[model samples]
Target: MNIQMNNIHKSFGTNRVLSGVDFDLREGEVHALMGENGAGKSTLMNILIGLHARDEGIIMIDGKETYFANPKEAERSGIAFIHQELNIWPEMTVLDNLFIGKEMTNKFGWLSTKEMKALAQEQLDRLSVSLPLLSEAGACSVGQQQMIEIAKALMTRARVIVMDEPTAALTEREIQKLFEVIRALKKEGVSIVYISHRMEEIFAICDRITIMRDGRTVDTKDIPETNFDEVVRKMVGRELTERYPSRHPSPGRKVLEVKGLTRQGWFENVNFDVHEGEIVGFSGLMGSGRTEMMRSLFGLDPLDGGEVIMKGHPVRIRKPVDAVKHGIGFITEDRKDEGLILDFSIRENMALTNLFSFSNKGFISGAKEKDFVDTLIKRLQIKTQSAETAAGNLSGGNQQKVVIAKWVGIGPSLLILDEPTRGVDVGAKREIYQLMNELTERGVAIIMVSSELPEVLGMSDRIVVVHEGRIAGELTREEATQENIMTLATGGQ
Candidate 1:
C-alpha cells in the first residue's frame, strides 16, 4: 500500500500548523520524516491517524481518496501508528494486552485465554522476542514493551505503519533486533513511516527521506545520495557546528555526596559524588533504577534507607516541595506525565514550581509571571510565537526546552536531568549541550541520566554505570569507552 497526502492544510483557530503539507510512503520502503521542534510533524501524524481533521486536503490510500473519522477507521483501512510513548496497560499481561479489543472468544462469549495466549506466543516467537506471555506488561523492559506494541499492530494486518521515535528507549543490541523485525516487515511488503531525530538510525534503515520545515515539505531524496550534514541542513535550514561543546574543567569541592543510597527494591548501595561545576552522568540499562534514584533525590519517591548529603550536610527530603526548598530541581524522564501541565499556557507551566516568588502575599501577579517566562524563553531560545501559547501545541523538542526552562527559572543549586535529548533534533541537542555547559559554568552541580552512550561520554565529567540495582563501575573522561561502559552495564567482571 502507498499513502499520499496532497495539499494538506490544518489549523487551530488562527494558528495554522500545517500548510499545504505533501508527503508519501511506498510499500517495501521506509520513509523517514525529519523536522525540528514545532515543524508540524505531530500535527500531520495526528491528521493521518484521525486524531484531528484537516481543514483542507486530500488523503489517498492505495491510490483512492479517503478520510478517516477516527483511529478505528484508520485501523480498518490498514493504517497503524505506534507513538513515541508506549501505550500499554501496566497491570495487564502481555497476552491480554495484545488481544485486548479483539479478543478470541469462546462459545459463551467469554475471552478464550488459551487461544489468545497461543497466538500471542506465536507472534512473539516470530519476532524472536523472548518474553513470557503471562508476564505483566510493565514488568517487561521498555524495549520488550515496544516489541509487544509492534506485534499487536502486525496482528491486525496493517499494511502501513507509522513509527515515531521508535528507538529512543532501546539499547544497541535491542535496536539491532528491532531493525531485524523492520526488515522482516519490509519483506512482507509493509510500508513504514519512520520519524526520528537520530541521524544514524535514519541513515541505517530508511530507503527514502523527506524533510519538513515549518509545516511544509522541503525536499525528498534517497538515503544513499545524501549525508547527515545535508539532511540536517534541509531539516533545520542551518549548518550545525560541533554537537557537543568542549568540556571546561572548573571542578571545585564536592557539592553533593551520597553514601550508600538505597531504595530497597529500586536501587541498592548507590554511592557517588558530584562536585561544584561538574556534570556527572548515570548510565545503565532501562530498569537499572537510574530514574528511581533521581526521583528519590527530588523527593518524588520514598527512600527505604541511605542518605543524601548536600555540601557536606545531610538534608532530609520528604516531598517535592521540600526538595525544591532545599535548592534541588528535577527534569523528569517522562515529560508528558511528570514534567509539564499540557493544558496550561507556557507562562503558567514555567511558573509551576516557583509560583510563590511572583506572588505578593498569596496574590498572583500576571505581569511578574510574564516577565519571568519571557526572559527564560529568550535565554533558552525557545521557538514560540508568544508566551501565551499552550505547551501541548509545541513540538517535542520545544516542549522539552520548556521543561528545562521551568527548572532554570527556579535557580536550583543542584539539577537532575533524565534523557535530556531523548526526542530532540540534532540542532536542538547541540543547544541543550551548550545549555548544560552554561549551567556548569555557573557552578551548579548537575547529575544526568541518559541511555545514549555517546551523550554519556560526551557531556559527563565522570560516568557511573549501574547494573541490576547496584553500582557496577565508575569512570572518568579518559577511561569511559563504549566497550568499557558496556562491560559494566552488562554485568561483566
Candidate 2:
C-alpha cells in the first residue's frame, strides 16, 4: 500500500493552485501533509480521490501507474477518504450509512442485513466504539459521528486512509479515543495520510511531515528531526515569533448582559456579561449549549425566555435583523453554509453587514462601497486576485477572513465569534487573534464560543463554562486552569 504522486499540476481558471506538487505515502506509516490554506494540499488530495482532475501528473500505486476516473475507482483500489466535513445522512441509521454504496447483496441482489450489521459491528469494535448500529446517525454527538466515519472506512477494507482534520470539532476525550483507533489501524499495517491545521497533532501522531506552501512542496522531514518552529516557518515562509498576540484587557463598563436566557430543550437560565474592553470566552464540551446561547443572544435563534440588555438598556431582539440594528454581529461555526454567499463576489460579501452605510436614500454608493471593501481586504490581508472574485473561489482561511472583515466593518459594539479558528491554519489563526485584540482595544466587547481549551485560556479575560444547558462555573483569567475548567465542564464542583 504505497502512493506516489509526481509532477502534479492543477488550475481553477487562471488561478493555479498546485504546480509540480509531489507526495508519497508508504505502508504502515502515518504521513502528515502540512500546509497553509490554498497551499495545494487539498487540491492534490482531491485529484487522488477523483473529486478533481489534475492538469498534469502521474499517480503510481505500488509502482504501477494508475488513474482514478471517479471516487468508486479510488475506493475500489483500497483508498478511503474521511473528509474534514463529515458526510452522513441524519435521517438514516448508522447501519445504512456504513453500507451506503458498498452494501452486501444476496443472490437476487437483495440487501444482506445480516452480513452488513455484522461487518459494521466488527468495524465499530475495532475502533472501540459503542454506538448502536440501528441508532439515527444524526442524533449522535459530533464525536460519535466522527467515530462512525472511521468505522465506515474500515468496513471498506481500505489499505490507505486519508483523514483530513479528523479532530477539528472533537473534544479532548474524543480525540484521545480517535488516536487510539488510529494506532490500532496502524498496527494492522494500514497507511494513513493525515492532514491538519493543528501543528501539535503532526508532532504527536505522525511519523514524518511534508510541508506545502504556495502550491509547492517546501520540505519533508522525519518527526524526530524537525521542531515546531521550523515546520511553521516552512508552511508560512516566515518566522513566527509568538503564537498568540499580547493582550492587556482594561475592563470598561458592561456593554452586554444576558439574564435568564433559555431555549426550551436546548439551554436554560444562561447568563453572562461582556465588558466594553474585554473578551469573554464561552468554554464547554460539544453540545454544552454554548452555541445555542450565542445564537439566541444574536437573535439568529429564538429565545424562549431571556432578557438582553445592551448598554444598560433592555432590548427586545426577536430576529437577526433586530440584533443587527442594535449593534450586534455573529460569525457562525459553519462558514461554508452560514457565513458567506458562495456565489457572491468578495466585495459583496464584505459589504453585506455594512451595506446600509453605503446606501443613500435607496441607492448604494458604489464609491463608498468600493473604498470600504478595498480597505478591509488590505487591512485583513485577504488574498484574492480582485474584489470581484467570487467568495467561494478563495481558500477556507481567506473566506473566514472575509467573513470577519465583513462583520468587523459593520462596527458592532459587541461581536460573537463561534469557532472562529476551526479550520484556519497557524498563521491565519494568529492574525485572527490579533484582530480580536484590536477589536477589544477599541471598546468593542467580544463573546467567543470555543471548544479549544488552550484558546480559551490564552485569549479570554474571563471564562464561562457551560454544562448540560447550565452555567457550570465562571473563572477569572488568573483562576482559570485546564484541570479546573475540565472539572466544571463535566458537571463537577
Candidate 3:
C-alpha cells in the first residue's frame, strides 16, 4: 500500500503536536521516522492510525483519499500499529495474544482455538520465532515477546505496519533476527514505518528517512543520500559533535561495594565496587544477570547471601527504604512500570524519592515542593506544560529525564542506573551522558547497567562484564574495546 499524508495538523488543547507535517511511504520499502521527544512523530502516526482526529490534512492511500473514524476502521484499512512499549497482555498465552481482538470464529460464531494455534505457529515460523505457543506472554524473554508482537501484527494482514521503537528491548542476536524478518517481509512487499532511537539500526534497515522537529517536517531523504550526522542534524536542528561527554578520569575512594553478592538463580558471586567520581559500567548480554544483580543491590529483590558496604561500613538493606536511607538511589529499567507513577503529575513523580525533604511537621509545603520541583525541571530540561501535567503525558525521552531527575533529588552518594538511555533520542542521550559527567564531578558514584556497548565504553571508567549470572571479567577504561568487552561478555578472561 502506498500511503501519503499531506499537511497533517493535530492539536491537543493549546499544544500543537503536528503542524502541517507531510509523510509518505512506498509499498515495498522500510521508512524511518526520526525526531526527538515532543517533536510530533507520535502525534503524526497517531492521527494516521485514527487514534486522534486531524485538525487539517488529507490522507491518500493508494492514490485514493480516505478517512478513518476509529482504530478499528484504520485496521480495516490495512494499517496496524505496534506501540513503543510492549502491548501484550501478560496473562494471555502467546497463541491467544496473536489472535486477540481479531479472532476467527467457527460456523456457529464460537472461538476456534485449533485454527488460532495453527495460524499463530505459521506466523511465528515466518518470523523465525522459537517460543512456546501455550506459554504466557510475560513468561517469555524480552526478545521473544517482541517477536510475538511482530507475529501479532503479521496476523492482521496489515499492508502497512507502524513499528514504534520495536527494538528498544531486543538483544543483538534478536535484533539481527528481527532485521532478517524485516528483510523477508520487505521481499514480500510489506511497507514498514520504523521508529527508533538507535541510529545503526535505522541506517541498517531503513530505505528512506523522514526527519521531524518541533511539530514540523524538516525533510525526507533517501537512505543512500544521507548519513547518521545529517539525520541527527535534521532532527535537532544543530550539529551534535560529541556523542558522549568528556569525563576526566579521576577515581577517588570506594563509596559503594558488593561483597560476594548472590541471588538464588538470577545471579551469584557478583563482586563490584564503585568509587567516588567514577562511572562504573556493567556490560552483558540479555539474560546474563546484569539487571538481576542491580535489583538485588537496590533492595528491590532478595539477596540471599551478600554484603552491601557503603563508605567502608556494611549496610543492612532489607528494603528500598533502607537502601535510600543509606544514600543509594536506583533508576529502574522499565520506566513506564517501575520508575514513574503514570497517574501522578510531574511534581509528584519527581518528589517521590525526596518527599521527606519537601514535607514539614507531618505536612507538605507547597512552596518548598514548587521550589525543588521547579529547580529540577529546569535543570533536567524536562519539556512539560507545567509541574501539574501528568507524567504519562510526557514523551518517552522527557519521561526518562524525569526519572533521572527524580533519583537525583534524593542526593544519593551512589546512583545505579539500569539501561538509562535505552529509548531516548541522540540529543537527549548526549544530555544524559553530560548530566552523568556533572554528577560524577560532584563526587557521586554511578553504576550503570547497559546493553549498549558503545555507551558502556564511552561513559564508564571501569567495565565489568557478566556471563551466566557471574562476573565474567573486568576491564579498565584504557583496555576496554568493543571486541575485548564482547570477548569478556562471552566468558573470556
Among these predictions, the greatest TM-score belongs to 3
* TM-scores for candidates 1 onward, in order: 0.95, 0.94, 0.96
lDDT tens digits by residue: candidate 1, 172-273: 877877789889889999988999998889999999998999889898999999998888888889888676789987898888888888988889998989
Instruction: Judge candidate 3 against the unseen true structure and give its global Cα lDDT, from 0 to 1.
Output: 0.89
Residue lDDT tens for model 2, 1-493: 9899999999888999998998998899999998888797877888998989989989999999988998888999899999876788878999998988878999999999999898888877766678878989988866678788878888888999999888877888778777887887889999999999988788889999889999998887899999999999999999999888889999899999989999999999888899998999999988888988888888888888888999999999998999999999999887776799999999989888898999999899999999999999998888888999999878778899999998999899999999899878998899999999999999999999888888999899999999999999999999999999999999999
lDDT of 3 by residue, 1-493 (tens): 9999999988889987888999999998999999998898888888888888999989998999977888788888888998877787889988888888888999999988899888888877777668899989888866677788888888888888999988887777778888997888889898999999899999999999999999999999999999989999989999999888788968789998888999998898888899999999998888899988888888898889988899999998888999999999999888888899988999999998888998988899999999999999998888888999999999998899889999999999999999899889999999899889998999999999998888999999999999989999899999999999888778877
Residue runs of model 3 more than 4 Å from their true location after superposition: 105-111
lDDT for residue 179 in candidate 1, whole number 0-100: 89
Q: How close is candidate 2 to the true structure, as a TM-score?
A: 0.94
Our tally of clashes for model 3 stands at 0
Looking at model 3, residue 235 earns an lDDT score of 91
Every candidate's lDDT: 0.87, 0.89, 0.89
Question: How well does model 1 score by local distance difference test?
Answer: 0.87
